[model samples]
Target: MSSKVSLLISIILHAGVAFAQGPAFERTPLFILEKNRNPENIMVIYTQLDSECRVQKKRGGSEKVVFDFYWLMKRKDFKQVNPIIKKEIRSRLELLPSNDTHSFSVMMNDLKELDTDIKDFKLIVTANKKKGNCVTESILKLGESDQNKKVKLESIYAESKGFLIPTVISVTVNGIDAETGAKVTRKYMKK
Candidate 1:
């Protein structure tokens, strides 16, 4: 084949591959759960989780979660906090030394309400132990509801270090939030 024709063929093939892969998403809503055994006092679980987005209104759908957590010990120095979502620290629950297993549930909804599209967001859980800190993270994603009759939901686990118990982070394409300045606000659970 002529060099010109070969070049044209190569370009066509590359274009086809690129188109088949679909648009690049900045933050994907998939997560893989990671089990950390270093700090053994904390456990986190997600219940009643859901996410949706309304493109026409430029408003994101309600992203809600039932955050069930358990702290295995109670001490004067023991600290358990969700710093990202909860800004203020209140009455100490661990003022007195006790062996009681402390557990509580956090219900946070309306996490990703933005003028632009949000692919997904992450919920982080961290537990403070005398030995070290252990972290658990979960991610939520929203898809086209009307277009796809059945909205697919699945769970994947990932490992990362950062943040303390019951924290949330909203993720969007850089372009989307640049102009709108819209962000997700976290609701703290009543103590």
Candidate 2:
């Protein structure tokens, strides 16, 4: 009887750990930009969300929910590619506006448009920085699979010299279901 009890406890512990880890998601690359200018600068950003809701009762006979958000950033030199690094820093400060409402979807669309215009410029090429300021927002919705399960996400981007670069990403998970929603995770680097 004791051996059976021990095995049962071990199984329960392992199941708890697995449930804590939540569902799995893969990272997706979004954009890459290449510039041959003096003092080139490159930036990349990533964001993710994890959450779980349990229907367990506490000692007081009440249930609770849990959620979390994570964000990360990575940067590299422009000279790493085939082109030699020109001047390191062009303008002392590359101003990023704050008024525009930037998001992953908007940035994706803007990048597509910029890619077309970039082909036209040659030698000392300068792409127009994104116009206006930058803004971020988030929203959450429940899923049909589980009443306790839901997905939440937020996206942010900036306009620089006519080029739109994504900057901030936020995500939220809720409810009892594991799978949530779709998100863009790719990094943009200039060639």
Candidate that scores best on lDDT? 1
Q: Could you tell me which residue pairs clash in candidate 1?
A: 31-156, 32-156, 32-157, 32-158, 33-157, 33-158, 126-165
- Report the lDDT tens digits of candidate 2 across residue range 46-133: 1121221111122353221111111121222212222221111111111222221122211123333332222211111011112321
State the local distance difference test value for candidate 2.
Answer: 0.23
Where does candidate 2 have its weakest 10-residue lDDT segment? Answer: 120-129
Computed on alpha carbons, the lDDT of every model, listed in order, comes to: 0.23, 0.23
Give the lDDT of residue 59 in candidate 1.
24
Deviation in Å, model 1, residue 37 alpha carbon: 17
lDDT of 1 at 39: 35
In the range 10-93, model 1's lDDT, one tens digit per residue, is 432232111111112111121111123233332222222112211111125422222322222221122243663123211211
Once model 2 is optimally superposed onto the true structure by TM-score, how far is the C-alpha of residue 160 displaced, in angstroms? 10
